[model samples]
Target: MTAADLPEIKILIDATELFPSSMLGEMVQQFLSGNEAKEIWLVLTNPQSVGVAYVAPEKLTDGTFNLLLIAVHPKQQGKGSGTQLIAEVENRLKELGARILLVETSGLEGFELTRRFYLKNGYELEGRIRDFYQDGDDKVIFRKVLT
Candidate 1:
């Protein structure tokens, strides 16, 4: 997506309340401008923006792609949008010769569905960082072997 799409994308992500609205614009700008990462993908539903996925080759790692961000609008949750987005990403990563795809999320009550989604999609828990987000929130990393 382009930098101009950030405002609407930020709104969709903010609806999930998974990230701070203040930080999304900068992140989107970095990816869109190719200032930090290589590529990003967005899923739109007609006139409205519904989902987004950002991915980049891992630094110092061979054939690894980081699934930087993936979010679907709150209203569109459980409708297979997220699943389809992730599947498309896997296909693209495979085409790029990536052997592994990694995604990280918070270990909080609100993020249980996210963790489950990854697992249901064949990702395994690879690691966890305690109290990464705050005093109680942890960072959980999941890895999927694309081969």
Candidate 2:
């Protein structure tokens, strides 16, 4: 998506804390313009919504896509929405020549549900960064081979 898509993308961020959620538009624009990745893939809820997953090209050493953000409206959870979104991403990334996917989640003590969700979705825990959240929470890294 382009920087122009941020306004709509912010609505999706408001449904989750993938980002500050307050500056969804600005955040998306910045991500889109940055050189951190070769490309960014955004999947929306529909023609008028912003619930999405931002998949960026991996960093210098990792030859994969980084799942930067994935937020679904709470009201839409547990209905296979997350799975569908991920499936779309998997297909798109495959087309882009990606061979693996990497994701990281904050290990906030109370965010067990989020951690479990990733595990249930076939992401295997690869490592952890101690106290990575600045709130005494760790950061858990998960990976899934796409090829």
Q: Which candidate is the best by TM-score?
A: 1
Quality of model 2 by C-alpha lDDT: 0.75
For each candidate in the order shown, give its overall lDDT on alpha carbons.
Answer: 0.85, 0.75
- Candidate 2 Cα errors over 4 Å, as ranges: 2-5, 30-37, 46-50
The top-ranked prediction according to lDDT is 1
Candidate 1 per-residue lDDT, tens place, 71-92, comes to 8998888999999889999988
Question: How do the predictions measure up, each by TM-score?
Answer: 0.87, 0.80
Error of 2 at 28 (Å): 3.1
Residue 52 alpha-carbon offset, candidate 1, angstroms: 1.0
Q: Can you write out model 2's per-residue Cα lDDT over 37-68, one digit (the tens) per residue?
A: 55565665555654577787766755588888
